[model samples]
Target: MRYAQVFYISIYLLAVSFKDVLCIVDPVSLSIGAGVGLGALYGFNFMKDQTYCRVTECCNERSIPGNIGNLRDMLQKRLYGQHIVKQQLISALEAHFNPRISSRKPLVMSFHGTPGTGKNFVAEMIAEALYEKGTKSRFVHKYMGRLDFSVEKNVHIYNQRIYRDVVEGITECPRSLFIFDEVDKMPPGVFESLASLVDYNALPNKLDGSKAIFIFLSNLAGVQISDQLAKMLKNGELRENIKLSAFEQILEKASYNLDGGLKKAGLIEQHVIDHYIPFLPLEKKHVYQCTSAEFMKWERYPHKQVIEAMLQEVITYDRAHGLFSTSGCKTIEKKVATEVWIEKQSV
Candidate 1:
């Protein structure tokens, strides 16, 4: 709209100039000459500025708008924390995409955490950041729980398919991101099988050397629960002879009490407490509650004020519930080893 207005104003100025020239020369000749001059000026300016090519596709060497740097810039803009995750991601990118290196590969990140702890939200932010910066990545959300990729054969098939699609997208567009959501739902084999791909040097390649970012978002709860369930079955506590109603009640109460203890310990945020599920490790008396610092790291990024407020909120909730004392939850602090990735410019 702004450009159109400018163009129209320029044309009007040209017409006024022609009118002035008309007072000195013939109207038809002046108008034609002014029009020709204006056209020539516009063409010269457009070509000289290369304004027509907002997004270049000339060659591999031609600069692409959203490349790896754009993605890094975007994530740095969105995420505010001095966590190892961000730094690790940055270092990995730098190493993998370094032109100095003889070969390059895609970056694969595995995000393992409890559900509702903002894993997917972070992934989306990072992906959108990459997109805004000019990289063409495929955000393939392979939700494990919703889909059937658990069997050994099925897991292999799924990984191969994902690998093929991601590679194709990256080759088509030099920089791309391929996200695999709910990866824990797949059999353990899938994770092990892609170990090479996850690592930098061993990235599988097609005829082209270009690569895409590979990411995995997996909920640790599912794997923990499955392991616990298997153990229970082996111990005969969850045998066929065991009553289903009794098991259900025990599971429910265990979950509630475990979640209550976590809240009482001030090791989890109120929102996390609300969404807590009782996995076996927490309920089976096998796992000790995490320290406040560890909990803060797992539950929230290492933002000082945010972690402090979260602990305070948990303490308040615990007090209201008449749960265990929240005395040790205080003095929770974080000493960051790496600089936070905060973009100085709009990503």
Candidate 2:
């Protein structure tokens, strides 16, 4: 809309110049020349800028709008064994995405727990909740710690790329979601590039980090969280009684004392991170629920006896007579499939 006037004036000037050169041209010839020239100039400017989204698939201010109810339902339905993470994440997102009372800071959340405990899964759920295309959305960017910053020698190079990509992403969509997987193995210096991006006052080049969200997934603190859950259960506390407060101090201390992700980074001291969510280990009931869900996903009937048999044969317990699955819900689908394959072969 803003460029329409300029385009029209330029076309008028081109037509006048063409008329001066083609003074003896017929009326039809003049019209054709002017029309073609206008088209040519429009195409040139369109290509020169090259940033315009000709199609409607591009993400703009309204593309990745999130529904808090949808997010809550997704967490409650899909994510199992971590009541604390689901509630904390939902509450934190509500606060961050709230336009009326937002703190004007990027929502920085770190997910800590055992692998397969739904750290990455929850991140994907968040993307799906916010985006039409889910993780495939252009507004969603994921960086693998091992693949993106494998070598410590390239810390400087990684720093530049990290800053450039994050800045570009935030500039494009303020509601962008950036997920960093396996951050436990990420180089400490890598956090340096991201420190300011999560800050409330991060205004490099006037880019607002407040509208974006950053998620870091790590297996760090998994043992501590699991141990705490086990102790709480042993003390006769109901699983539903488990709350964020029980693990909040534990997570804070883990971030400082344990060799967790961003442990050496002082984001905690700067009070940049909004939440440190802990994913609990999967218990018998949660694992059974996951197995049932996986079977349903594969269009297989979730038989009670079959599920019990598979869990018995495949799942590794925390200890003798332990209630928790050491590996959480990580490989439930694979285990289910293998059990089905074996049963088919035997039959």
Candidate 3:
């Protein structure tokens, strides 16, 4: 519209100048000026339309290639101690990419766990696997629930913003991925606003987000999840025997019982989500595995004494019911890096 207005003004100015010169020129010259003015107007309009079309096509056509096998391999390599997470994620991707499925709703997934349990890490890995730029891809957007919905009264405003952002993002890239972190802190209304977008029904808003992915990460069901794990451990059960399906109902119930964003939004009641994958708490061994991986990534030679000493300094374990990293493996990398630097300085 703005360009059209500019083109019209330019044409009008040219006509006025041509008319003024007509009085001082011959009939042939006047005809020539009129012809030249029409040609310029036509050229300008053609350029305007072509430029607009090119810009729109570019925005709508940008997409990244995705591979299921590569994604699975990347998730396995980068994320440790979350075997169920990797398997479930692979399953979800397979179903999402199934050629026979005709659902209009986006692939909605919820990641439940305690802090530092690789919820966010796995989310990033998915993004990285699907796109070459990974989390840095323009199509991959990460939003924090706390920051996005900090104001209670202005939730409606935030909801509109969220909807607009998602729609606009999908419009630009149909294969876009949206990640909501700290979902436990999000308001219920915010998720409600997005329910329609995540539903299986075709969107009346004409936004085709079927190819997009929406991942919700929260610690809402962390305690219940951990309690379930603790009980299994108490019974002398191995971690490998802890299947996700066995306690899915318990996790769902716990999520609904909580006052967190998912419960408030009635996501559980609506069953809008396709998967509710739980991230188990990191054991002391898992933390050690994370530390060892970080040490290798940093090219630090693993010294048993130094590693054990560093673990003691960085890890806070419970004595009563065996050892678990309360912070999960969140701080292990930095702690390991610092320890390695100290060891180098000492040498």
Alpha-carbon runs more than 4 Å astray in model 2: 1-55, 339-347
Model 1 worst lDDT run, 10 consecutive residues: 279-288
Best by TM-score: 2
Q: What TM-score fits each model? A: 0.40, 0.81, 0.79
Worst 10 residues of 3 by lDDT: 54-63
lDDT of 3 by residue, 57-97 (tens): 22232225567788888777767778889878898888887
Best by lDDT: 2
Q: How many backbone clashes does candidate 1 have?
A: 4
Ranking by lDDT: 2, 3, 1
- Native-to-model Cα distance after best TM-score fit, residue 313 in candidate 3, in Å: 1.6
Which residue pairs collide in model 1, if any? 66-133, 66-134, 66-135, 137-177
Native-structure RMSD, model 2: 8.3
lDDT of each: 0.43, 0.78, 0.77
